[model samples]
Target: MLNTSEHPWKLVGPWYRPSSLGGYAVTKTALNRFSAPIIQKYADANFANNLVNEPQHSLRFNSEDFVQPFSGDPNQVITPIERAQSHTPLKLYLNTHSRFYVVVCELHCDVAGFPQVERNKVCEAGFVVRRRVPVITPELKGKVETLLQQRSQLQNDLNKVNMQVKTAQLQESQQSSDISGLLKTKSARLFSGLQSGTAEKLTEKLQDTNGQLDQLSQSGDIKIELQGWKSSDLKGVGNWLPIEETPEQITEQVIPMYPLIADPTNPNHSANGKTLWFGVIPTSLADVDSNNNPRFDDADLYEIRCFVRRHHSQFPIQKNHTDCCGDVIWSEATEGYQIAAHFDLDGTSHRPVNIKLPDLPAIRNQVNNAPAGRGASARIIAPAESSLNFATDSMDMPQGGEPLTRAGQQICFFSIFLFFIVAMFLFRLFLPILLFIFNLWFLLKLKFCIPPSFQFDAGLVGSLNFDGSFGADFNASIDAHVELMTEFTADLAVQVAIEGPDLEAKFNQPNFSITVNKGKDNEKTYVDEGVLANDLGLMIANGINASDDMRADIKNGGDSPGLSSLSLNELAGIFIAMQTEYQDVKHPELAGILPTPDSGLVYFEKVELNKEAA
Candidate 1:
């Protein structure tokens, strides 16, 4: 029996024969045991009898003129349909025989499409055919199961290795962070230590010393002789006249022994043609006696001595030229000529003595009273005994032993004071040397206290571990003993013809895939020990080498070490020599040292003369 709910089929043809008879009828029914006989009887007796008896006339009808039971194109192919589903009819045929007419129809069935099948044999046979049977052997199944289990184990091992690798990476990262922090701290400490230690102190000291030396150099006195005069020439001179006083004198006189021209405009001219010569008399004989009387009579004037001065304005004069009177001497102050010639008043020399008569009324009266024709040369001579007596009496000398003893005591006290001043000066001069010696000893002691070398350990240890992996597989197989069988049957006899282009279909099997993975795991750990110690050692070695080089430079008297190259004794000696030379050159008066004689003093002289002799 076919259940109507499961199989939906409809019947359309129960046509009567004659045109007078009614049109065909359509009904939906189930082919079940209860309704089957009634349906068959109606079709065989009533419908068939009417068709056989009345169908002598021909009938023509278009398929399109009738309403189709189903919608869509009847000629369209429907593929890949499921089994037992209903399909539309494509064509219908009618036949007549001696007994009755028959109707035949060509119909399509709905069957699922198979891409693996090449022909319609399966559909025609209505069942698949198998030539060989395919089966899974127990041994093969067991092997596959074992392989799967092994793969699972390998996956589990890989997971564990991944966890271990992650842990190692974490440890390495932490260790690196710690090392970086430690290095930062250590570097800061090293820098601070170097900044605050011996090198810094030494640099500061050197800078201070250099600054002091610069100040001294700038502030110390410098001696310059602007007048081009030697120290001896300036000995008794209070101050030099300005250059404006002697504008024509640009350079020092090269031959000062020779007298200079008295007047630039009149070099070869004298003051007057008539030369009035004079003689300089001794002060002892030129002054009056205590009685204010002349010491020599006119006849005794022959014993007097006198010098005459020459008058000339000519060059190339001899030192002792006596053509007219005596040697000529020039004076810058007087801007005139003088002489150094002397004569005896006893008439032993031919030179005339032109002495100016003393301005006394008594002497002038005696000269005027002389007889005009007597040829008597009246002269006045003062006594030297009275002037000597006055000088001797004017001097105040210590009169007794007590005053002399007091003077001696004063000299002793002054000597003691000078001794103490000298001692103090000596102490000051040697103070730098003493201090340098003390500092050197102290520094040597400190140097000896330090150890030559040092050792240190960081006490650090590190370890690391890591692991990882990859794999792929491909499998393909064909069944050798399996086949498919199919069968098909149809009751109606009909011919089918395919039209137009032949139907063609192409199918391709899907491609298989393979996956490849590449993995790598590597781990390394490093531990550095005594990093600080190594750095400190290098610093110390460098410092020691520098110190050694400095010491060698000092001992070798090289200027690389600057003033340190000089020993305390040598430095002291140099300072003392410089001080002595400075004093001698710039402050000879302070030391009671006289100026050294030079050629310039030979032409200039400074002296005090009595008023009567002037």
Candidate 2:
């Protein structure tokens, strides 16, 4: 009976097709099956690296076109090779016929679009199965829920601590601002009305205020303490727990049959005359009932549907034309081949490059037959179950590639923050030193020079010699007028004129005065001729011309000539003589106050007297 029911083929694995070249080519449909929602944000492409050992194209995830059945007739629809380029067609023919296996199977409509005979061949060779599904246990569910709640509570506590730290920081900033304002105001008042006692009192007040500000500026550090989850906590919580199944229950159930090995007659069968079946059994079915008996009858079985595929290769073959039928000839000049060997004696060795026989099983056997000697201790033990569900998202990514934990992120942030703080602290500590050095350098650039000067009773004059050392040509002159009647009892006047590098001044006294008591009451005044002594005695004692010139002029002008040219040294000598003679005369007294002959000129210049003195 021809059954026209729906095909039962399901896409449980990657779609792979044999290429004209050696390796298999994986399609977008197969690649998308392995993709998870976590990586869906990335562009759709053949992200599966090295799946079939060939480069793949980045194509759109169009399941509509992928699941559609492609017509078997190469003439009606596109060629199989062409259709494979655009989409992975489930139905494929290798351009040859073979009498393959026969079995009752549920074939999906999309798997094949071959003729009735070809479709029947696949159906007769393949089948599907259904198994009992497992369930989760209450104990494991309760443990997971408890852990989730704990995690949530810890996160809330961490947020509260962060808020507290922020609040403390704001309070510190406000306090610092207030203290800064107070300091500025107090400092202005203290300096504006500064006094000896007031300065000390203000300084003490400022120290107290600064101390308070420091206390307020200090803040507490925030610490996050989380109780890490442990694997021991989840030791008894299994992923799934299944119920028991008995022989009575099995007899009542009509279970589907699955074929592990395909017959050699089928075109899809491997070259070695065997088809390897692979399928995943879900954890729900594999889970065991821990409380059940030792026979493990409480456990259930789950079925996972996976499609089968074969790898193909094509190579050119040519028959040897020589007398030897299966002989090959190597030519050093040709590098490739002068002749190829024929595998079949009756048939020609020539074959198309695109046509190849399957050899995957043979290669697998060769790998299994690898020698275990020479320190190679590893061995290939066949797995009891051939199907495995791999985690596709983590296939290319490395371990610890996910986002960091909250604690780890916080530690990283604090480390960077500490680095910035240290940098700012170093800048603050050295900034004043750098500025002081620069200011000192600027002050040194501002040089000043001041010249020497001379001052007098009326006005002041200065000299260009700033070092206070004068050469012999250095000149200083002065003139003075005196009233006639002040120093003498007779009509007398003294006029002085000073000139010369040594500065000799001519002192001329027209007459001197003396008063004598005649008898008891009558007094007579007349000019005394002994010497015009002590004429400059008062001037010498006052240190007006206190230089060697004044002393020389004083000593030289003391006798005989009523008036003569005299210098500061001559005047000093006359004063000494007068002091000795006038020991009985009550007038000028000598205390050695006259300038010593060795003493140099003592000149004082004031800024008001000499404009250039500044």
Best by lDDT: 2
Over 239-292, each residue of candidate 2 has an lDDT whose tens digit, in order, gives 222322211121111222233343346443321221222221111122222443
Superposition TM-score, candidate 1 onto the true structure: 0.11
Give the range of the ten consecutive residues with the poorest summed lDDT in model 1.
484-493
The C-alpha RMSD in Å for every predicted model, in order, reads 73.7, 52.1
TM-score of 2: 0.12
Candidate 1 — what's its lDDT?
Answer: 0.23
Query: What is the clash tally of candidate 1?
Result: 20
Off by over 4 Å in 1: 1-235, 238-614
Best by TM-score: 2
TM-score of each: 0.11, 0.12
